[model samples]
Target: MTYKGDVTVGGPADVHELTDLMISKVAVGPMDNNAYLLRCRATGEQLLIDAANDAATLLTLIGDDGIGAVLTTHRHGDHWQALAEVVAATGARTYAGREDAEGIPVATDAALDDGDTVRVGQVELTARHLVGHTPGSIALVYDDPHGHPHVFTGDCLFPGGVGNTFDDATAFARLIDDVETKIFGALPDETWVYPGHGKDTTLGAERPHLAEWRARGW
Candidate 1:
């Protein structure tokens, strides 16, 4: 079915567009987790990232296109409250980082490793394992043919700093290093970041504050 109206934050919001792909975001559940739906404009195939709480809302977002796959960024309960329901409803394949797959309520059909690529129709999203928030926490990177990259950082990197490390100093360092090299170091300033919660931010806006995050040691 044709998706009516525009996408919004609490509803469905059009995040951005690649050559043949359109990214949409919807915030759901008590924690206000952001669930992202990436649709291939050419084929109508769709992929969802972080199918958090409120299965009804997610199902509505899934709509007639259905889903080709569901990629769980981490095993956090808040991130996958609707995982089993969505997978059961659509029969879509499931994928998650190898280290964290087992914790998920549903079995992962494929294991995601750093540098792995997941495809939705013709669009390809590269998985980057950014361990810290969770041992298998990951961020998916989508590179637009004509623009800077866009990343779905599950619970990893956010606008202010990396996701909470649960007071683990070692995990905090690991997250900081990966964000610096794999993210801030590799991509241009224009890269758009859609986090697990709250507003969207660009790498350019958060780049200068890296030092502050490091010094504060969060």
Candidate 2:
């Protein structure tokens, strides 16, 4: 339950006012897991990612925020435990992978697959499956208003570490490979990565660490 750093507040305006999207990060509960509020400036369309264990905090921050949907990265309790409450508060549809759909208490409004695109106002998010930490882990990829792509990695990839794996080691390795080749390699160097835990990092900063992590057999 350590608070690693201050909760970062950022958006399209924080970078450039001309950008049409805004993103805000709220660190909730003792775990300090980051929950992102992605808002489309043009239409006031919003998406909440990973409510974590603290429903009240998330609800308070998202009060009448006009959330359009809730996107979950995996089935971990610390990541999605507040999903039901958030959905009830916002009356927003929930999206998750079909494989982990049953684990979630509420009915999933949409079952996303790898490469599927989800549109929120002017934002288009491409779902990339990365099943190492859980059977249905995925990352959301989209082009920011600045035209630079960004990835919401959840627990799949952190600034200096990868997601915890209760599954087989070999399977986790494969997941790491998918993240490197498909996610990190696919995006531009300037692409921002918002992870479930820790500070935000760029693809350029994390790319060199991939080789070191792979060498360590993570």
Candidate 3:
């Protein structure tokens, strides 16, 4: 498969091949959340990003390889519905953004800060904390050496606009600012974005609309 990042709940996953890592994207739950299983090519170690929902499907995806960590993008209930069960089954360490750790029901083994590094075997993902979607929402950035950078942005970002802010101007501002500075400004246009819900997009594809997203204050 081409790894288009298009998936439907209960459908088979779309796998992306890279030199050192393999990305398996599967959509789960009623909300249609996307859960990614990142497997390190060398060590065969894997790390699951967002155990969003459907433990049975997620477990079956894990197979016997297992995972080292389950990092929640935010404290939102829909994003971590299967965390407890997935963690229990794999005995994987639980990680969440430092500020959102208290909000998550599972005991967080590691409370990540802005630039914390989470490893999946030899592969590493840098945590970028983008506020607004939730006080402690974090996006995982994977800079594949052989390829372009990839970001697992939770609800903070999407294809057309940023996540819903409930019309809160302050949160909207913070989110947009962080997104521009931490995401858009810092990352190149080619950075591939894998969001929490819906289809995927690239920073390049979304850069032109930053002003519009800010102007609308969404």
Among all candidates shown, the one with the greatest lDDT: 3
Clashes of 3: 0
Q: Which candidate leads in TM-score?
A: 3
Per-residue CA lDDT of model 2 for 68-176, tens digit only, reads 8998888877778888888878899888877777777778899989999887788788999887788888799987656788888989988886777654688679778
Error of 3 at 202 (Å): 0.4
Measured against the true structure, the TM-scores of the candidates, in listed sequence, are: 0.94, 0.88, 0.99
Better-scoring candidate (lDDT), 1 or 3:
3
lDDT of each: 0.88, 0.78, 0.93
Q: Model 2 misses residue 200 by how many Å? A: 0.7
Residue 80, candidate 1: Cα error in Å is: 0.2
Write model 1 residue lDDT over 13-35, tens digit each, in one string.
55565678887788886888889
Residue-level lDDT tens digits of model 3 in 1-218 = 57799999999999989899999899998899999999999999998889999999999998898988899999999999999999999999998999999999999999999999999999999999999989999999999898899999999999999998888899999999999999998899999999999899999999999999888888
The list of candidate 3 runs beyond 4 A from truth reads none
Q: Give candidate 1's error at residue 83 in angstroms.
A: 0.5
* Error in Å for residue 73 of model 1: 0.6
Worst 10 residues of 1 by lDDT: 1-10
